[model samples]
Target: MITTKDLQHLFALIAADIAAHRDHLCELDGAIGDGDHGLAMDAGCEASVKAVAALDPAQATPAAAFNTAAKAFLNAVGASSGPLYATAFMRAGAAVKDRPDLSDEEFLRAFAAMAAGIQERGKAEPGEKTMVDAWKPAADAALDAWASGASLLECFDLAERAARQGCEATRDMTAAKGRASRLGERVIGHIDPGAASAAIIIASIAKFVEQHDSCRIDM
Candidate 1:
């Protein structure tokens, strides 16, 4: 089972990973966007980690942890990406509401809910060169792997791979959404900054789950 403390650790991993890639993400955005995607994502992740870390893991449920993260992220980032991710976390929290700890299947469901929420809030579908390109495929692959009886670690591995592939695919797609869309075919050679960040987040989550496979907090 994954506890609230485990969730906290996961958030930290994501924040750290984002920090590590901040410059690269910004560089990618500079090609087709405002060039501040990395900075915005870093701020949001830092805020989310701080807020979630402040919670009492033993007392807080997974839902509470996720909701806290959502609020913090939204508060930290005012860009369009902020609202998209806030809705994602909110949907995740709702999916796991009332659960003290999370089973593998439950966690995957919450992950899927996050993707769904992003899709709804962004009004972007796959191939739109949005973050949804990465998130939606990753969620689908992870959930499908879980359904096939793969271990949680294996499911996450699949998720990371799918997210990377989706991110890469964006390089060839004409932007159909966001600021990049205004660039028309000029965006064809550049990967979407949002998609790149989404892949990074999924990779970090995958690593977290792999590292914690045998160790759990508050369990």
Candidate 2:
């Protein structure tokens, strides 16, 4: 079962990745964006970590922990992406509602809801040169791998690969969402900032789950 600890670990991993890739993320944003993606995400995820860490254990259920981070991310982030990402986790937490210890199926439900929420709210899709491009693929892979009776770790692995491939695919897509959409064909060949950040977060989650997972089957 995935506990609050597991969710905390996910936040920590993303925090570390944000630290390591801050400059890179900014560099990517600089290419086709306002060049503030790195700082914006760093602030958001860092605040998310602090929010999770400071959770009053007395009140810290799995759902509450996620909700706290979502709220904190919104409070700390000041970019166009902030509301989008904040909505993702907030929707996920709402999906899980009162659950404290979540099963693999529940985890799927939460994240799948997050993916769908982000897509719907952003009005974007896979290959739209947006975050949904990466997230939609990862979400699809997660569901597919799990339904095929794959181990939880295997499911994450598949999701991670799909997110990465989707990020790369954004490079060839004409931006049809966000600021990139304003550039039209000029957006092609430039990676979308939202897609890149989403890929990093998904990859970080997969890596965390694999390294700290204590119960993944060997299948």
lDDT of each: 0.94, 0.85
lDDT of 1: 0.94
lDDT of 2 by residue, 77-153 (tens): 97877788788888889888898688878887788888898898888767778889899999999999899898778
lDDT of each residue in 65-144, candidate 1, tens digit only: 99999999999999998999999999999999889999988888898999999999999999999999999999999988
Q: Which one wins on lDDT? A: 1
Locate the minimum summed-lDDT window of 10 residues in model 1.
Answer: 210-219
Error of 1 at 38 (Å): 0.2
Question: Which residue pairs collide in model 2, if any?
Answer: none
Candidate topping TM-score = 1
